[model samples]
Target: MNRINAHNLACPIDGALLVCHDKQLRCEHGHSFDIARQGYVNLLPVQHKRSRQPGDSKEMVAARARFLNSGLYEPLASRLARITSALVPENRKTSLMDAGCGEGYYSDTVFKYLEDRGASSGLSFIGLDISKPAILEAAKRNRQITWLVGTNRQPPVTPASIDIILCVFGFQSFEGFRHILKPGGRLVLVEPGPDHLKELREVIYSEVKKSRPQDLTPVMETGFSLVDEQSFQYKTGEISKHIIADLLLMTPHFYRTNKAGREAAAHLEVLDLTVDIVFRTLEFQNP
Candidate 1:
């Protein structure tokens, strides 16, 4: 197996090949970025930023780290590992990128699972997120994986160089993904199913509304054809108050629910949560 590192990164400003120097990445025409001591780089340029601080906040990331580390979502992580590992190109160096990987929980688990299954020899991993705090926490998960603070609109990677990209409940542009994924590359998206967290929503919202399935038409229009999709659902029979709190803090519902809704959730001593998620694999239809 060839040892191909995750050096297929590009300058966020000028899109030139980034060569690593001592604790820094430098591209031709003098674009440079310093790698943080925690083993990640800030590839997001200020000009491309929508705000001074973007994506998940520090508190949110901390909550996510706590919740994910609890192994409550181990089933989902296992499914992700199985899907991604099977997509690894036979006997060739494969590059996997987790776009919008928050704190790298899923990516780290999947990467390690692949490694333990003997795929690490020819696999390179990159975890990118717009949130600095999220990427900072992600960097601590695995030093071998390249973690970068970046966004989906302008991913700091070489065009047409990636083999697989995993976007888990993240906002993204399939058209932009087309530029980074090579011909026949696989793009896996994990989305929340309609019944996901229904129990929690029932308690928080005044009236629970069913969620619609993600539309695939727009994604197909972006030159991606759906390959396969699978759904996973399970119930956590009984979870404690703190565990529920951690779950809430890690999700968008933390902000979406108002004070009364939050108070309703907090008052519950025990809760049963149904975890429903979908994993969809799409192939880029190169012209």
Candidate 2:
């Protein structure tokens, strides 16, 4: 069943340790966050929220759920699981946090992969996102993970405690990550490569500029050194209009594109896409 490592969580308001009490998370400073009926927790304090709604909207989360559940991205998920499994300690308890885990597709898939390999015992999985809608959707995928609605700038996980942090195409707070990750802990990032969804970009943008996926030099200077990097790429034969729409909705391009670009996409009966992803692992080191 799903369980939470409440022992590692902190109160967003006071930065005090939080524990599960009476189905709520309470800290010593009297700060309490409620665990929703869906079994996820809302740890994002109102003060920390940038707007009335901070992260992805409900419609975006729904589209993300639909696209992910369709298994078109299963190869990516499988590669992530394989990479994560290699980093897990064999005999010790470990904690993994999926920062900005949208609807829990990757986390859930990784959990099942580890479980199938008999490597899931004594592991705590946390799925965190700024979007309540995303966390709400994630909580339904697997009860084994602790899903929280919280911002990355101030993640509630305790300092120097997390074993691994996995972020996929999300905004990151490197300072926050450095604070929470243990020495020698790994940070895995999955970023889009230069040609990732180029076809889609061609349809939606007046001009497309393809560049490096990311530069880790700044991150390396911040106490994290690159450990490994791998490129994963694939092409789909043809996807239907409905799937294409769902894909567009699940990405930021939907909001960035003009109406004419969107209408052009809508009229396409089918389109093939190139999925280029870079999987990088960086290790946090003590100063």
Candidate 3:
């Protein structure tokens, strides 16, 4: 694994500043973390861990990997890459951090886009997740980028070190994101729109709760300025039973689906799923 500048790291043990010496990251208080041979580091302290295994289960990870590899979400990835690259300046070497990168699908796609455009050499990608297994799997696929097992509450990266941050259909820690982003750094958030997967939702639950779409005013209040927004809707042609099962496992709806709903999905002949993907780009504001 490549050794990152310790100056860009913080002590997960005490939240103190970290210093790098001889390929090791050490805190001012003498706490130390070692870089792994695979070119990544573990910043998650044991005390902060609530479980022996954190984050998505192995089964969920496998299901997600399989579903994503099928290229069902390739169009979404392409849009993300296009928007993110447009926001970043071409002259500067950029660093992108995916706060909840699961299985590295989107991050890998974005990195490949930069490479294909001859812009990858100046860019560094980091995928961070609370799930150790997910990070481990991501490391195997992209050796050039960094992978860390950590939480969004206290991102392991040093303050003001990131140029672009991505939060894609995952958790978001607005305060943590603001702390790590450089001045004028960009943050891209991808969320499921109101009409997202309505077909699946209708089948999974007895009563579909209709709530107003999320308001971005609160997000902007947290020291970010929204720059651009776009919405895309597409129908995923009739899907098979096996694909339905994988989709169930890959989303939170699995647990919320009623017994009747599951039975319906199981017996259904085909599913024509519709997705409304929303993307928002925000920039960090000066304090």
The per-candidate count of clashes, in order, stands at: 0, 2, 1
> How much is 64 displaced in model 1, in angstroms?
0.5
Residue 62, model 3, lDDT: 82
lDDT of each: 0.89, 0.90, 0.82
Q: In candidate 1, which residue ranges exceed 4 Å CA deviation?
A: 1-4
Candidate 3 or 1, higher TM-score = 1
Cα lDDT of model 3 overall? 0.82
Q: What is the C-alpha RMSD of each candidate to the true structure, in Å?
A: 2.3, 1.2, 2.3
Of 2 and 3, the candidate ranking higher by TM-score: 2
Q: Rank the candidates by lDDT, best first.
A: 2, 1, 3
Q: Please give, for residues 1-287, the per-residue lDDT of candidate 1 as tens digits.
A: 11115879999999999998877889998999998888888999999899999999999999899988988889999999999989996789998999999999988999999989889888889999999999989988887788889998888999999999999988676766898999999999999898998999999999888775579987787789999999899997888898889889988898999999999999989888899998999999675
Tell me how far candidate 1 lies from the true structure as C-alpha RMSD in angstroms: 2.3
- lDDT tens digits by residue: candidate 3, 1-287: 66462246678877787776765678889998877776667888988688998888888888888888878888899999998778667778887898889888998889888888878777767888888777767777777677777888789877888999999987888888998899989989999888888888888887877533468788787789989889988988998888888888889888888788888878777789887888989999766
Best by TM-score, which number? 2
Higher lDDT: candidate 1 or 2? 2
